[model samples]
Target: MRAFLPLIALATPLALGACGDPAPTYIDQAWIRLSPNKDTPSAGYFVAHGGDAATRLRGVLTDYALKVEMHESMSEGSGKGAMMTMKPLDSVDIPAKSTVAFAPGGKHLMLWGVNDTAISRGKMTLTFLLANGDRLLVDAIIQKPGADAPAPKADEHKDH
Candidate 1:
């Protein structure tokens, strides 16, 4: 009986590890930068993670803005003004256990014609449309570009 006890203990931990939960297929940490001026558009970013299955991000919808689009920054060619363009995207795939980061000068969500309420200060509910018709509702955290203060850093200590 004593010899069999050791094998049972080892097997218990192995079973637990094999029974771990599956990965998440969702978007989180969604944030948006407030425009420096009312005329300019804002950039939204977030992370997308799909578990063992693959998924794709089709587009986005938000009532606060006139238009929402998935955009990739372009190198301004020899134009009169800043070289940029807004090209329509079909979809973005989210592979299993991988993350997609949307940020400035990258693949990001462009929020145009934001209303007054969402301009200076407010929250906006943006739903990310998936290829599978799964809707992931995300909250866009609003803050003016270089507004009142800088973002607090992890190394920044309160005591200091």
Candidate 2:
């Protein structure tokens, strides 16, 4: 019995480690910059962390905005100095155990026709549609033009 105790204790930890649950997929550090001109579209940013299985971000839905779409910002020199363009993204892949950032000057969300109430509240609810049929609900802080977003660390997106 005493000899078997050591083996059982060693096996117990290994068993738990092998059967441990994978980290859940989630969104973090989400925020939206409302366009000062209501006519123009606003921008949103966030970081999506994948879990054990890889997933793709299909789109974002928000009742506050008339339309929300995923977009990427790219800069190119078309013989006219530097020009920036926004391209609609059909989907973005998030690798397992990896993080995908929706940052400015990179991949981001374009929010159009945001409701006054939602803007006034200073927060908005965004539903992230994943390829795996999972919807992630996140509340994003809304920032007005010239309003300072909480000081973001380097690499985190912050609206200027």
Candidate 3:
């Protein structure tokens, strides 16, 4: 019985160590660039960190905006002669243990017909719909056109 007691203690720690909770997916540093012309669509950006499992960003929704879509801006040419083209994206994959950044001149959210009151408030709730049956709610900071929003920390941009 004494030998069995020692074995039980040895196994107890291993069992407890295996019971860790899975990391949850989340979003941070979310923001929307307000357009000077209300008629023009505004751009939104954020960083999404994947959980223990891989997932895709299927869509975005906000009650303050009439419509939202994911998009990517690509530069076709090289150097000073580069031309930018915007392409709509169906979804964005987030690999496990990685971070995806939606930044200026990169993958971003297109917000059309934003409510005037929401704009004046300087913030709004943005919901990110994930392919794996998870919805993340984040508050998006509103920035005036040409406002110098802070850049993402270097470490947070590991994967696009």
TM-score, ranked from best to worst: 3, 2, 1
TM agreement with the true structure for every prediction: 0.68, 0.81, 0.84
Q: Candidate 1's residue-wise lDDT over 82-155, tens digit each? A: 77766657788888777787766678888888777765555688898888778988767776686442343454
Question: In model 1, what is the error at residue 36, expressed in angstroms?
Answer: 2.4
* Maximum-lDDT candidate: 3
lDDT of 3: 0.91
Please list the residue runs of candidate 1 whose C-alpha ends up more than 4 Å from where it truly belongs after superposition: 1-22, 74-86, 147-160
Q: Model 1: C-alpha RMSD to truth?
A: 6.0
Q: Residue 23, candidate 3: how far off, in angstroms?
A: 0.7
Clashes of 1: 1
Error of 1 at 28 (Å): 1.6
Residues 10-121, candidate 2: write the lDDT tens digits.
9998999898776667887888988889899999999898888999999899999999999999988867798998899999999998889998789999998998898889
lDDT of each: 0.76, 0.87, 0.91
Which runs in model 3 stand beyond 4 Å of their true positions?
A: 2-18, 79-81, 150-160
Residue 127's lDDT within candidate 2 is 98
Indicate the worst ten consecutive residues by lDDT in candidate 1: 151-160
Instruction: Pull out the clashing pairs in model 3.
Output: none
Report the candidate with higher TM-score, 1 versus 3.
Answer: 3
What is the number of backbone collisions in each predicted candidate, taken in the order shown?
1, 0, 0
Q: What would the TM-score be for candidate 3 when compared with the true structure?
A: 0.84
